[model samples]
Target chain A: MLVIEDLQVELAGKTLLKDIDLEIRPGETHILFGPNGSGKTSLLMTIMGYPQYIVKKGKITFKGVDITHAPINERAALGIGMSYQRPPTINGLKTRQMVDICAKTKVDTEGMARSLNFGDFLDRDVNAGFSGGEIKRSELLQLKAQDPDLMLFDEPESGVDIENMALIGTTIAQILQKNPPRAEKGKPFVQQQKERTKMGLIITHTGYILDYVPADKGQVLYGGVIACAGNPREIFQCIGQMGYEECVKCTI
Target chain B: MYDLEDLKEKARQALDKKASFGGDLDLNTFDRSFVPHKYLAEEEICAIPQEEQKRLIMSGLDVTGHGRGGTYFQKDTSVIHCQSKEEGIQVIPVTEALKNHDWVKDYFWKLVPVDQDKYTASALLELHDGYVIRALPGSKSVYPIQACLYLDKENLQQNVHNLIIAEEGSELHIITGCATSPHVKRGVHVGISEFFVKKGAKLSFTMIHNWAEEMDVRPRSVARVEEGGIFINNYICMKPVRSIQMYPTTYLVGDNATAMFYSIIVGTPGSYLDIGGRIYLKNRGSRAEIIQRSISNGAHIINRGHLIGEAPEIKAHLECKGLLLKGGIIDSIPQLEGHVEGVDMSHEAAVGKVAQEEINYLMSRGLSEDQATSTIVRGFLSIDIKGLPEALKAEIDRAIDTSNKDSM
Candidate 1:
């Protein structure tokens, strides 16, 4: 579980996110929709405690502990992980080595690679010459290795093709420990007992990931603030009918 | 052909000319005649501490000195022991080889001409002792021939002229190590190595140097590859040295021949190093690759590389990279020359401090800041050397591991 109250963030002396509030309970997933330069990534980076994301006035609590000014690495150790939209390329560090470092406990990396279909890239430089789909798969693979309780996905479906989108969607669902929508029909009774303990806050613009990852709530971020909160499906339908400007007007 | 007297006179005359780009050490200020010619008896060899002696030997040489193919141990300027088991293979002292074998004169000092610089000239004129390895035509051996050159006394100068010849269709590997005792306060080492790879032969040479902070080292080397031959050179210097200046050159004279140069240099406090590699693709279909990696910590390092494409259809590449930890200076230069229209030559060089993002990424994975910094530094120093035997690779890996530990 995570909570944020009145989080006003500034970058380079310019206010990016103003008076923002967000909360995610255990076993819950929240979908955040915003246009370009609408402070979607700013919110996630702020919560992750990036030094550049200056929090003018706010408090962030994770598992009943105030971690407002925690270091970036400290937040990562405290069960918080993120998949960046564009990760830096490390020249000499191998992909498998990075995965081993991320997995603090013993992990079957070969098995994980097989599941993610990235076995050939295990020995290559991290994200050096990867395609769009390959980079996404690598990010997800590292996140899986981290095995954090709170997952933050930044545009997981931004540049993925339709074929790889299905795989990314299903993996995101599994990471959240949620039953797939396709498996919702004719599910076994024993399968219903699967524990759902992980929480997620995913940022999306196209809303394509909603088809794969089920969200309990949706919020519209406009003008550096949360404009509305409602059901994900209903909010997506409303945004499709009316542009983001109309949605902001209706919410206000 | 010049006789021995003529060559000696030529080298003596060139001893006054300094190298174009010199290091911090000035050989003129020191007395080169203070060196003593002391023989290392069996008991005296064992008198040196085991730890210090072990540091002088290559990583994979754990067996006794007289193990497999051959082993040569030299202290100061005298060859203490030399042995060989295999037929058609000769490992003898250079002075003895020059006197006994009439054919040895044809290959000695032929590849690495002594009149190039004063350091090389000094090594040729004032040479003490070194090894001469010869593999007869069509002979093949899997075991590596090992040699250890060490300085044990103060104010000593060990100038050696080593020659290695691989006849046509032969394959050989040479592993040499150089070190000095901690008590050697003022010393100078000038080593000259010349390698000749005949047609269709393969030769791999790996040298590891661990010297004290009071030593000044100057090594000059040259290799000539004939038709359809391959040459690989791996050079590493991990410990602190007062100054070192070396730039080994390789010439590919036959078609379908290839040459590779791999070097890793670590500069500690109060050290100055100027190391580089030069390769010439002189024949059609000849290829060359030069890779240099350097890490500077409170020291100064100058890394240089040059590739010359002289014939059509020749390919060459050069790469130089440097990592700065604390206060240090590193100058990396990679030059490319294409004389023929169809030849391809390119080079790349980069110098920068370690990225904060990389350290933070590692720290996020449960490693502390120090651990993260060490990990990145180690990765930066670990280069991928292709086409080496598994055993040789393992040996190089162990030496690299030792270097990493000592660097920090």
Candidate 2:
């Protein structure tokens, strides 16, 4: 669903990501592994078309259209959504109002909020005084309301507790329409085996989210370049034992 | 009739004193009161078309006499219309009430004394026509009495003295709309309003003003809430005006008395608005809260809130928030004074531009930049005042929305 070719990104004359190339097909989830300040967020922001993330070179093609210079809202309209690691707080804008704006049509916001156990926060200002878990859930709540085709998760498990992690994991699975964990009572799980066409690119530092998300492919990004490509679990084990320097040496 | 010789002398002396100058707006041109040769009579009042009056009053209030209440209309110095739909509620012209009833004159200028300021002095001495509203003892009203004071002729000075009395155990709501003709070149309005909330009574007052750019407005008001009584004041100014300087004070005099003041002021281009709220907690268990939000777009705005805790067990809070758009200036001052032990007082003030991250966040949710900016501005101007009727809340919301669009 998304393809990036030789993407070189810069901010304030400093190169962040250089010669980055990646592609995610339909029904595929890509796990991006990197260390701190390894340009994981810059890649996602570059794809999302934030004005400050200057595209020095390369083009981002999404759903067969090159949106390299598209505005932020234009990208959002074209089925691109993101969950920020640390979203800013809006003082007077209500959560429900933001949800309403995200929805393409009339949406059952209360029902969605209830499903996420965020009913009490519907009337509060967006992200104002929210805990880390609550902020992650708020981002997920907005993504759920938006129902975008291409979802980008920026460290979903970074600041989440175990209890909330399980809830968020289940909600993310439901939103991405991943294969259900198990069938309902008196219902077969075979129905969930049908085509799952939602595409996602989730950035992770701890690899804790692999227990919930079934990633098809994993790639380590070292020094603003792709270091290696393999199974996410295998790459996590390799990084755990050999460290990122080993992966960079192998790539070189 | 009482002796007026001393009062007239005081008014003459007050006229010599210059207008108070604490606000940041430049009002050299309006330092002296704009005195007209004569106010228009009932015949000349027709110069203001009926459509303009409808636009100012009924368009914003959405009142159709569904419940029991009254309506008062004044054009310049004439009392155009006054009627009461329920018994035990007196709605009459201030002069008429003073001529017939003894209590009207007693409390007319009592709460807001004539010597309070130059504007009050001018209104009391050169005042023309105003309203005297009274909810009798033990009476309760589900609907609000509506009043519209419109400026019709150019260069007309509309000085009014209004008195609202809610007797013991009575409850009433008053909505007053002050506006001028859209094409009015120049005018001056000095309104002195005094409210008396008797023991165990509740009074809610909402004032909405829409003025042209050439109009100057000075509103001086004071309220006395007695024991076990409650008072709520909602003030909104959403239109552009030359200059407006007002800071109404409320005194919680009796035990367990409470006051809440909510103000939402929007300053359009080239307009200068200096508005504030003050409350004094005088007795034990008295409480007061002042919340004000100011939005300035290429205009100058000053939001000031002051609270004083005088007696033990008294509590007060003042909150002021200001949003400055491009080329506009906003100064927020929140002050709290504690006079006695065991008295609590707090204040918070903030002034800044809208957050760019907030705007970008909204845009990522499918809204255009303009849409996102307007939504935040509208929300910033929304003051969630407690104890207001749902209908009045909706009215205030509509007024805020209109102002947001107009300013944009």
Candidate 3:
């Protein structure tokens, strides 16, 4: 489980987010919806322990451990990982090698890359010249290799073309354990649900990923706070019918 | 043929003249006296002292000669071992070549001027032993020929002149390492090398330097490529040295000829390294590229590159990148000149520390801060050299790996 209470984040000496509270139990994926500059990404970055996102007064607990001040690598080691929207290019480090680093052991990088249609990019420098969809796939490929217990996806479908949307969405779904285990076919639904231990928090703008990933809950961030919380599909319908102004009214 | 007396006089005139760049070293402070070692057979080379062999191996000279096409081992002023295992390849000491081979006179001082600088003059005046590795016409080397210039005498100035030639339609790969014995605290090395790539021929020469902290090195080298030929020159220096300054130049003299120069430099504290490359495109369709990567760990380094395009339809590029890990100075100078309207030349130079964002990106992949920095540094040093043999590429990677360990 992951929990954030009374979160007030400041960046570069400016308050970006404040008075935020959230929780995500195991076997659940939450969709984050908000207008631009509503501090959605800031909330996720604060949760990941970026250090630059100073938590003025808050507590972040992950898997029952207080991790409000943990470093990025420690957070990663404790089964928390994030797929960046615009990761920096690391020259001379092959994607193949990056996968191995994420795995922390010898892995079938080629096999994993093939599954994501990224086998051709295994030898290239990490995100050196990747296209939008390619970068998304590369990030997802790493996340799959990491196999973190709590996964964070920051706009996974932003720059993807229609051709790759399904691929990226399905891969994200599989990583979140939303897809049923193929080997456990014909198993009881309750048993399958009991075995789904991975938790996910995805930030989206278009909500196109909902076609593939069946997010259980959703929240609207308005004025640096969670304005409302409800079923992800119902929230999407309500936000589509009425602009984010409705959320602002609800917050007021 | 050139007059030997005239060359000697030119060298004498420049003997006391200071180089245009780099720190000046007084020649009178070091010994140039001849130091001789007995010729070592193949088996004897393998049976040498283990400690000394370890030093040589770090510089990429394997005493076992397992996969080498030839071996040339010069210790101090003596040619201790010289042999060629493959057919149509000649590994001869420069002195012996001058004494016996009449054709050697044609190439002795042909490419590099004897009066270029004080270091070149030193190599010409007090000449020690160097190698002349040549590939015959239409011949191809099965494995890279290995050469070593080992300095064992303390405070001695080891002067050497080397010539490498690839005849028409032939291919050659050479790996040469220069190192000092473990006990030598201080020394000076002045080396002159000239290369020739004949028509339709290819030559790749990789030089690795491993020297002690008190060593000062100066190497003068020049190359000429003919029509339809290719030349690849690589230089790697990772260990600490008091001072090293060298700027090798290549000329594309014939149509469609290509030349590429790649170098990696690492400077530790108390080290001063000034290194670069220059390529001149003189004919139509000639192409040239000079790429350099340097890191300074509290040492002062100067990286320079110059590309000149003189003819129509010529293309050239120069890139110099420097990373400052510890407190040190990195001066990157890249120059490009296009004299003709149809010539195309470009240059890019950057000097800075590793991007924190890049480090953070790696850290997010679960690596610690130290691991992230070293990974980026190693990647920054790794360059994909075109046409390099797999074995030679592996050798370069191994050198970078060992140095990465030391630097971290």
Candidate 4:
């Protein structure tokens, strides 16, 4: 479970996100939808504590603990994992080794890689020479390896083909099933980890992932604010009836 | 400078005598064994070369004996050359270490042989003070015996011969560093170092060379690894030594033997460095690995490294990467060739500028653009900083950090 209160991100002296508030409950998949440059990826990076994007005037809480200023590795160790839109290639660092390090001995690599179809990249450098799909699979393998309680997915379904789309969908669903959210009463979302397996906040411009797994909430972020929130299916239907451009025009 | 008359007179005086002690050497002990002989300097000539004795000098390598083109340096000159002394490493000049430590002395001759050229042979053969170094069976030491050679005017042609012997099961680390006094005159330097590692021996050698910016340097060195022995050589070049050309060769002659070479040749504007390493697997079960990294700016660097596995179970590897900053040119040649089966040999080479994404990402994280660029550049150079000893690795890390901060 995670909470963001009036979160704002500024980069290159420009406000990328502003006045954004979100509460992710344990065991629920929150789909963050937006058009290009809608601050979706920027929000994910802010949550993960990437140094570049200034927090400006926001607070991010992971499991009720303010992690607005945590470093990337610290966030990772705290059971927060983010699969980026574009993975970094760190030469000489083996992918398997990184998974092991991320897992912190929580999970095994062979099993994670096997489940994610990355047998060939076990010994290869981390994200080096990896195809788009391979990078996604590697991230999934790491996600499973780390077995974090909170997962942030940035365009996880962007580069996946229809064939692997099914695989991706299946794996995502399985992971969702593997870590159901906590539903305890009278406990803050911060301590919800004791009862829940895992929770996730996924960002995507295209609603293609709806073809695979059900999303609990579909929210469109414009001007760094939630313009609308509803069933992912209806939200997608709205986009279908009214193109993203028209929706943006109407919102502005 | 007095040349042929003086050298010939010395050679005639020495060679005319008979050898009552052909190979009687004092092992593990220093004794006076200065065999006065002609220090040859030829335009183009051939003579069966022998091991050299280099004297260690800590200061004064410039002021070559005075006046234009002189052959002699003052006795107290800060210049340090090989010396034959009753004290010092195993005494009696390194050239004769073979007789005292015959089994190990065989490797003393070609540390980096003085060539027929201007500096290679002259700086080595003509220098009067030199030392003979030998490591006996199972012998290991802590500190690196320091050796220095200095030159100035016309061309400081000094002959330096160094020998390192790791007898069976012996372990040793030797340091050969060259430096010049501030604002010293420029000259040419040709030096040779040869080492031999016997069965089960381990030798770690380091060469830190910082010559005058206007000097030309030629260094040729080699080592032979015997069965179960390990030899690791590291070279660090930091000064803007104008032109540098060196080829370090190693022969893995024993089964299950290992050799590693780590070299960093940094050349600034108006500088050129042709530096590399070679490993010849002449026997079964031998292995060698060569890794070279070069950073050049407004200069040219040519690096060539190769690995050879001669027989079965022999393993070898080579990795060379060059980083070119504006106006820098790099031509790298890495090769892995051998007939030995089951030999794991690979050579990877890459050339590129700083990664833009990494820079942008770091800069976004509160780091300045310069800080971002340097952080990534240091990261590139710190690739091997990971598996080193904690203290040494920390030192390396500190250096990178300092460089990064300075750039910032």
Pick the TM-score winner. 3
Name model 3 segments beyond 4 Å from true: A180-186, A248-252
**Model 1 chain B poorest 10 in a row by lDDT:** B58-67
lDDT per residue (tens digit) for residues B1-408 in model 3: 768899999999998888878999998999999997999998999999999998888888999998899999999999999999989999999999999998999899899999988888889989998999999999999899999999999999999999999999999999999999998989999989999999999999999999999999999999999999999999999999999999899999999999999999999999999997899999999999898999999999999899999999998988899999997999998988889899988888999999988877788889999999999999999999999889999988998899789877
Clashing pairs for predicted structure model 1, backbone only: none
**Which is better, 2 or 4, measured by DockQ?**
2
Residue by residue across B290-366, what tens digits does model 1's lDDT show? 98888898789998899999999999999898888877899987889899799988888888888887776666565
Q: Name the TM-score of candidate 1.
A: 0.92
- Order of quality (TM-score): 3, 1, 2, 4
Off by over 4 Å in 1: A181-194, B24-48, B57-69, B85-89
TM-score of chain B taken alone, every candidate: 0.93, 0.91, 0.99, 0.72
How high is the lDDT of residue B373 in model 2?
Answer: 89
lDDT of 2 at B166: 96
DockQ: which candidate is best?
Answer: 3
Give DockQ for candidates 1 onward, in order.
0.47, 0.63, 0.88, 0.07
Indicate the fraction of true inter-chain contacts that candidate 3 also forms. Answer: 0.84
Candidate 3 residues A49-111, lDDT tens each? 898999999899999999999988998999999998999988899998999999977778999
Q: Interface RMSD, all models, one decimal each?
A: 1.8, 1.1, 0.7, 6.9
The 10 consecutive residues of candidate 4 chain A with the worst lDDT sum are A175-184
Each candidate's fnat, in order?
0.40, 0.64, 0.84, 0.02
Tens-digit per-residue lDDT, B207-267, candidate 2: 9998878888888899999999999999988777888888899999999999999988878
Pairs clashing in candidate 3? none
Error of 1 at B7 (Å): 0.8
